[model samples]
Target: MSRLAIAAAAGLAALALGTAGASAQTVVSKIKDRGYVVCSGSQGVPGLSRPDEQGVWRGFDTDICRAFAVAILGDREKIRFVPLNAAQRLPAVQTGEIDFLSRTSTITYSRDTAVRFVAITLYDNDGLLVRKASNITDKKQLDGLTVCLQGGGSLTEKAVLETEEEFGIEMKKVYFDATIQARDAYFAGRCDSYVTDGTAAAGQRATVAKNPAEHDIIVIGKGTEPNGVAIAYGDDQLFNVVRWTFNALLWAESKGITQANIDEKLASGDAEISRVLGQEAGFGKAIGLDDKWAYNVIKQVGNYAEIWDRNLGANSPLKVPRGMNALYRDGGVNFPFPWD
Candidate 1:
């Protein structure tokens, strides 16, 4: 072959290889081009996802999505928050309407088959929200009660069934299209109690009730419900980004890294911190992101513990106890997956 022809063939081969590599990360490439991430959340469930006085989405779930935003784009505010009902979440993820579903979604066999679960970010159980006037202080007192529930494939709906079977009682289920609707029903004296995830139950009692002291949230099952962040099935490359970003929050908290102290930690000589913070090249290049991906997440959005405190603990009105949501070493279920 002529020298010129040989050179042209080599150049074409290199271009083909580059295109193939980029195409492997379809969801990531698409989001990068669009310049923002579509993150799924709940509709006006305080302590999970709800608008503040300024209409900005703020809560633990909002922060979970925000962590991914900063990890991928280095901008936590570059998020298009799509509030999803129970039925809408899975389809939105499967059809590419959102990057990942970060609502308090339980990981069941059916759901895991439909979409890839990034990680169980919240550990909770079903709970009943009751008015103190009703004098029903225990789950055993819930017999034959008319309960407000968000049915139609929601994990909250599953709570109804589980509660009935476990307590040996029947509940008259009054269903709603969304969580806020059900909470409203209970507040209007339509149902005896409102049933949902324990975290959201506390949110309703704290925020939606006429007086926070007038209501109580009673956790239903003794077993834990693992609520995961889900993405479309079969997108392994995108999965890696979302999964590690979720883990990075947990990892940051485990290592005593906080938004306030991250800068100091970054300057430390610790080898693991350096690698995780992307002071070295491997973590970022492997995920097709900037070297400071984990740093961006912790610095911009704060770690998992910080998010919980701001949204559900002392900083927020809810002040919900961290039961199963605490770290594994702290007598709860969450364990941070190692960065190595």
Candidate 2:
């Protein structure tokens, strides 16, 4: 073969490889090109994620979606919510039916192997909610009682089993496919109690109870649930985008940057806050975004504390304590990564 012909063939092969590489887009780019994020959240779990009477979605999970939307698309409203039950959430994520799962899903070893759990947004625990009229103050008093759960294959169901084993008592179990179904059955007097994570149990009692005062949440086990956002595994760039976007929320909260004061923060004399707000330029560009990406997220969704206050804090119906969800310096598990 002629030298000219060989050189031409090599050039064409290089061009083809370059084109293919360019076409293999990241999740962030796909979301941007589609003009919105398709996020999967809970099916009307109040304080965690639910739509109001006005059809506006709001909650801790929804706020995470909004923060992600703002970080990637630069517009908080550039996101759509899809509600899924416990049985359906992981499948939807694996099949790409949703771009990201922001529901109150517990991160576990099995799930981590199947999908990437970016960061823990809320630390949770398994617990039971019983009717106050029953006077059930202790878990031992309810031994052998009927309990309604989403299903046995899920984390909540497993937690129930583990609790029974730990307490050395057997509780009769009834299973359902959706949280709403089990919750309805419990409300209708079909079961003695409903099993779920502590945060969700509080949310259910507050949002769905006809008489909120008639229910009491019985804490079963004592440990962190480490619930987090889930995305498809094997995409390092996309994982970093999510992990650090969440980290930015923690970082902003630690630095005292709130939605109301983001603009002021952008012009502050502090080098760290200025860099975080994108006054200095390396943070966003490293994550395949513009310099103001973190700024947009904070300005739109506020920081971790602000989100918690709006959705699950004292003013909300659930009124869940920050507990392990607080910043590390403030006695919680949230420790933001250094932007430097």
Residue 332's lDDT within candidate 1 is 78
Which pairs clash (backbone N, Cα, C closer than 3 Å) in model 2? none
Worst 10 residues of 1 by lDDT: 215-224
- Write model 2 residue lDDT over 156-239, tens digit each, in one string: 777777778787888999988887789889989999999888888888888888988999888775456888899987666678
CA lDDT of each prediction against the hidden true structure: 0.85, 0.85
Model 2: residues with Cα > 4 Å off, grouped in runs: 1-24
Best candidate, lDDT: 1
- Please give the clash total of every predicted structure, in order: 0, 0
Instruction: Rate residue 217 of model 2 by lDDT.
Output: 86
* TM-score attained by model 2: 0.91
